[model samples]
Target chain A: MIATRIIPRLDIKGPNLVKGIHLEGLRVLGKPEDFARYYYENGADELMFMDVVASLYERNSLQDIISRTAKELFIPLTVGGGIRNLDNIKSVLRAGADKVSINTAAIKNPDFIKKAASKFGSSTIVLAIEAIKQPDGKYFAYIDNGREYTGLEVVEWAKRGEELGAGEIVITSVDREGTGIGFDTELIKSVADAVSVPVIAHGGAGKLSDFEEVLKNDVSAVAISSILHYKAITQFQSQKDKLEEGNLEFLKSGKKYSKIEALTIQEIKTAIASKGILTRN
Target chain B: MTVNLKQVVIVDYELGNLFSVKHACNKVGLETILSFDKREIENASAIILPGVGAFGDAMDNLNKLDLAEPIKDFIATGKPFLGVCLGMQLLFEESEEFGAKKGLGIVPGVIKKFPKEFRNKKMRVPQIAWNQIEKPENVDWGTTALKGIKDKEFMYFIHSFYAQPIDRSDILTITNYNDFEYCSAIHNKNVSAMQFHPEKSGEIGLKIYDNFKNLIV
Candidate 1:
């Protein structure tokens, strides 16, 4: 049996790794390459880099970052944000990303998925769907980092994307993103049950149980952000106290955030494995 | 031969990301180059056919570049050669993906799509996930491209169709997705191809490339 993947998703703004509460109040965590190296060493199954400002800036500013990350980080890297066309896909691939995830462009030009899939193979193209629950207890797809609504239901859009040759669908919950709440199990289960391709449940992974909750569904993988980011900060904070007091000035000057003792990838995998689910040891 | 000058050529058929492949080779301390030039193809110490695109288009590119025959001829020389993902599928005789299309016929097999449903459960196609590879008993892969890797170790996979080698003896590994078992890696003479991407599969994945590096060395 295939083990479920535990992926660390990093949202990039400029060259810095940023995290936001509910995808807002963005705070720079650190350099992407540094964090990527940390995650790669710590047993992250894959890494996802999304340029949160790409669509707004209209340029993929993380190309160099990705290129650098790919050099040292040997795991699978999936890059998203502002991927507008085949050229954007080509450039990202050239940067050494294994897969390109598209959200807005996929909605604007449905044919873009087909074109990219036809050109780069469906496996290289991932359709990222940011879904929101409406008042009527339904899910609708949103794009542009959940700032715009597509008016298309999540299930229907996922089916369409798969039909258009998308190899996987990453269903992110707008309702739960960055909240550290938990995955929208109902939404993920429906989407996972709807598509014939693998569905990755992104957003709202606050604890090991959260991963287990979503993994119980048909999701092939889970994309996490805040929890892991917090964990890295916590780990770094422990080392800071061991350094000379004057050396702490460098850490303070770089970036500072309250740390949480979040679980490591191995711990999460162990937790899941304890539940009788197989995971890479 | 000078150190750090080994020529491991990645056959670029104008499909997929050769950068990661080259980076993996470089990480393993193997000098890598991406080219479709026939002379480079014939002269390389080893050849890697890495691809991610339609079968027809890949074959079309190889045919247009006049690399199809050279590839076979290069393989005929018995130097190490590897095919990845779509590159692996192209080694089979035919693929039913996007209609019936022919392959390079390097391996006696047919590429098949996973059934829509398996064992009363809805099976996901394209199987984009990390699955373990079960090694066959008869083959001694202790010194081959799969060296330093244990049986049933996980590898990242992203594909809808899998190759069905006609000779079971040629299969190097098998992976179970849903109720069915499919050939995950095939090894024949100087040629070996895998359905998964070693470049994208982390540490163990790097070991596979290192093993390949050892093979050519």
Candidate 2:
């Protein structure tokens, strides 16, 4: 059996790592490189750098950051957001990203998935679906960080992504994201069951049990941002002077987010392992 | 620490992560050159065939650049050659990916894909996760680059196809995914290859590179 991966998702806005509630009210955390290095040292299975505002900006600004991190860090680095055409994927991969996650582009032109997979190989292409739960209990795919609706059902889109040769699928729940409650396991389970590709559960990870809860739904990995970010802020002191982009108020204040528990990657993995779940030590 | 003058020649076929491999080598204090030049590859003290794309495209690039013979010649010199991921798969006779594509045939084997459904249980292809590498029974890792590495150590893997060496003696490590066991690494004299990306496996991965750097005579 493949060991379940514990990935720390770092949502990037401009140059700084940021966190928000329900993917809104964005707050700058610190330089992404600092957080990335910390997570690597602490045994994160993989690190995801998602440009949360890339779609709106119409370009990805992660090349410099990805290249810098890939120089010393030796692990799978996945970059998502604003990846549209083959050139965009190629450039990011050349910039040292192991995989490129596509959302808005894939949703607009479904064939983009096929083109990317064929060009860069399926293993290098990840289908990132941002899903927002509807009032009718169904999940709909959203774009631009849950600002635009694609009108495509989450489960069906996942199946199509698999058919188009996506090696993995990351299902992010907009409703439960950043709430510190838990993962939207129902949405995760629906998508996981609809496709054979490895599914990465993102959004709504607040505590150790939240990770455990999501892993039980046949998901291959869990991408935790808030829980890991909160833990990191308390442990490591960022170079505040170097960061000039994004909101630095919360980070400079040194006040912790009271809602979520800060837990290290190792601690979470240990907790999962105790539950008989296989994780890389 | 004395600076080792030896350099590893990482083949640049435009299909693999050459930068990370070179960076890892440099981190371990080994100089490296990312090149597809035939003469440069043949003359290097050590060679690393790092790849991460489809088998057909990799082979095509190798042929296009006329690197197929030089790589074989380098291995023939017994100067330490390491094949990573698709690079390891390219050493086989042929691969079943996108049809039967010919490989470098350095090692006698065929690259086969992981079954989509094994024993009625759906298996996730492209096994993109950290899986443990175990020394096969009667295989002592002390002789190979995996020396000093613990048994069942996890390594990052991202591939849908795996190698099946015709000679059992070449098999270095075995990894089981979804109850399917397959060869994860191979050792044939001076030629060594692994299915996992040692450069991307964290500190343990650096240890592997360190071992490889030491292997250079």
Candidate 3:
């Protein structure tokens, strides 16, 4: 039995760590590296850095951040957002990311996944699918942080991605993102069952039980953003003086999100592990 | 030849995570140079072969740079040598990734992929999760780079193909995944290799580099 992975997902806007509800109205947190270091020290299974606005801007700014963070933290880092070509993937890997997740480019050109997997090895590529429930009760794939819809069904797309050589898939529920309502287990289970590769569940997750609930869906890992970020902000207390970009007002005005309950990575892992789930200690 | 004794040469074949491996070595207070120069690798006190990519491509890059012979020669010197992830797989004789591909043949083994289906149940390839490293029978870790590390310590792994040493005595540590236990690390005299990326395994992983640094003298 493989140990369930607990990953802390950090959404970055420029240099500041940011979070948004349903992938909109972004609120700036403190330094991403600070939060990353904290999570690593506190027993995070892995760390994910997603540049939330990289696609709209058509450029990634997290290279420097990834480099700096990779030096101190010795954990697997998966980077996503605006990874368009082989060069982009190469640069990120050179910056010390173990894997590069692709959502937009892969949807635009499915063959890109095949080329990347063959060139960089399948395990180095991750297919990220943003899904939202439609009126027909079917999940449709969305891109650009849930701003654009692709019309393709989530489960079918995940299965195609695996056939195209994606070593893993990360499905983020646009409807549940940042809501803290709990994971879209239905969406996760559908994708997990459709593909043989490992699937990582992202978005939602308000409490510890939320993790246990999703793990039962057969997700290889759980990526939580607001839950861990909020807890970390209160615990670490961002130094407002060091921040340079994004909306710093949130940091200045007591970082708190009423929609989600703050929970540490260790707290979530211990809670889930007690319920007969295997996790890395 | 006068070896630096403090600096470790990291073979750069343009396929692996040279940056993180070099960074990890630096964190452990060891000087490192990312190079493919034959003379540099041959003269270095220790060598760390770190990679993450297709086994065939890795071998092609190494051979293209004329590094195949130099690496084998370095190991023959009996100085500390470490292989991580694909780098460890490259030490074997052949791999089944994308059809049978030849390896550096330093250790007697062949790389095999995890079964797509195990016991009528589908198994995920590229076991991209943290798994434990347990000691084999009669094998004491106190004398290897895993020294001071706890038994069954979790290390980060991301690979589809795993090494199966023809000589069982070369097996250093084993890890269980998909209802199958496979050799995850190997130690034979001078060569020590791990399928997991110790450079990305956190504090416990840094301890491996620290132990490797201690072996430099």
> Which of the numbered candidates is closest to the native, going by highest DockQ?
2
Give the Cα error of residue B181 in candidate 3, in Å: 0.7
TM-score of chain B of each: 0.96, 0.97, 0.96
C-alpha lDDT (0 to 100) for residue A54 of candidate 1: 91
Model 3 misplaced regions, further than 4 Å? A241-244, B1-5
* Candidate 1 per-residue lDDT over residues A87-123, each given as its tens digit: 8988898888889999999999999999998888888
Candidate 1 lDDT score at position A104: 95
Clashing pairs in 2: none
Instruction: Put the candidates in TM-score order, highest first.
Output: 2, 3, 1
- Give DockQ: model 2: 0.80
| lDDT (tens digit, per residue) of candidate 3 on A1-281 | 47899899999888889998999989888889889999999998889999999999986889999999999999999999999999999999989898999999999999999999999889989999999999999999998999898989999999999999999999999999999999999999999988989899998999887888888876799998999888888755738667777777877888478878888888888898899888887
Report the first chain's TM-score for all candidates.
0.91, 0.97, 0.97
- In what order do the candidates fall by DockQ, top score first? 2, 1, 3
CAPRI-style docking class of model 3 based on DockQ? medium
Enumerate residue pairs that collide in model 1: none
Question: What's the lDDT for all of these models?
Answer: 0.85, 0.90, 0.90
Instruction: Please provide, for model 3 over B1-217, each residue's C-alpha lDDT reduced to its tens digit, 9 standing for 90 to 100.
Output: 8656488999988887888899899998899998999999999899999988888889889989999999999999999999999989999999998899999998998999899988887778878999999999999999999999988899988988889999999999999886788999999898899999999889889999999998986
Per-residue error for B129 in candidate 1, Å, reads 1.1
Q: List the lowest-lDDT window of 10 residues for candidate 1 chain A.
A: A241-250
